[model samples]
Target: MTGKNMKNDIVNKKDLKQLVIRFYGKLREDKILGHFFNHVTPVNWNEHIKMMYGFWENVLFFTGDYSGDPMRKHVAIHKKHPFSLSDFTHWNKLFIETVDEMYKGENAEIIKQRAQSISTIMQIKLFK
Candidate 1:
C-alpha cells in the first residue's frame, strides 16, 4: 500500500462488527477489566455487543445508528467502581492492540486515535 492511496482503505460495517465482538471477547477474559463486564455489571453480552456494533459503525462510517449518551453511561459505571487513569490506559492499550492485530489502514488508525481521545476524555470527566 502506498501513502498516496492509503485514504482509500475504508472499513466496512462487517469489519467494525467483528472488531467489536473480538475486542469484547478479550475484555471478558482480561485480568484488569473482566470484572467490570463479567461480575460488576453482569452484562447482557448480546445486547451490549449489538449496541457496540452500532456505536462503532456510527463512529467510523458515519452511519448514525447509535443514539445513546455514552458519557452518562460511563459516568454511572464510574460512580459504582471508580475507574482510574490506569484503567483508561489499559483499555486504550487493549483497543489499539485489537485494532492493530486486525487492520492496517486509515480507518484502523482513525479508530485507535478516536479510542485514545475517548479514553482521555472519559478519564477527565470521571476522575477530575
Candidate 2:
C-alpha cells in the first residue's frame, strides 16, 4: 500500500506514518514553516514525532488513538501570525508532492481533491 492508499478513500496506518514523516520532513526544510519548530524546549523529537503520527493517524486513518482538537490547536498556532491563503497554497502543494513522491495509487485523486476542499474550508473557517 502506497501513501496514496492510506489517504482519502483508501485508509491505512503505515501509509499515514509515511505521510506524516514525509510531510514533516518537508516542513522542517521549508523556510516558511520551519521556524515554528525551532524551540523544542526539551527536544524530545521522538515524542514530538509520535504526537504528530498519532494526530495524522486519527485524521488519515480514522484511528481512535488520537482525540485532540486540531482546529483549536491550529487557531493557537495561527494567533502567533496571520496565515494567508498563499501559505495554505504552499502547504497543499507540498502535501500533494509528498503524496505523489511516496505513492501511486488510484485514490490519489480523491486524496488531493479532498485536501483542496478541506484546505479551502479551513481557510474560510480561519478567515471568517
Candidate 3:
C-alpha cells in the first residue's frame, strides 16, 4: 500500500477509540444487533462509548484504563435479551470487519484475535 492509501496500525487510544466508535456505529444500524442496543438494552451512547474506549484500550495496550466487570455487564444484558450463538457470531464479524477496514498491523491483529476469544468465552459462560 502506498503512503496515502495505506491504513495505519492502532498505536494508541485515539486509534482504538476511532475503531470502537466506527464499530458501534455499524452495530447500531445492523438489523440483527441494533435492537439489542436501541431497544432491548438502550445504551447511553455517550457514557457507553467512553467506557468502551477505556475497555478496549486496556484490552489492547494493557493501559489499565478500564476496571469494570464486563462479564457481569454482559450477563445483565443476557438476562434482558437472552443472547444466542448467532448474536455472538455476528458481533465478532462486525468487530473484525470494522478493525480490518480501519487499521492493519500487530495491534489490529491482536485486537481481532482478542475479540474472537472474548466472544468465545462469553458464549461459553453465557450459555452454560
Per-residue alpha-carbon lDDT of candidate 1 for residues 3-35, written as tens digits (9 for 90 to 100): 664433335887888889999999988999999
Tell me the whole-model lDDT of each prediction, alpha carbons only: 0.84, 0.70, 0.90
Q: Cα deviation in Å at residue 12, candidate 3?
A: 1.3
Q: Looking at model 3, which ten-residue stretch has the lowest summed lDDT?
A: 57-66
Cα-based TM-score, every candidate: 0.89, 0.74, 0.95
Instruction: Supply the TM-score for candidate 1.
Output: 0.89
Pitting candidate 2 against candidate 3, the one with the higher TM-score is 3
Residue pairs in collision within model 1: none
The prediction achieving the highest TM-score against the true structure is 3
Instruction: In angstroms, give how far residue 127 of model 2 lies from its true place.
Output: 1.2
Off by over 4 Å in 1: 1-10
lDDT (Cα) of model 3: 0.90
- Candidate 2 is scored at a TM of 0.74
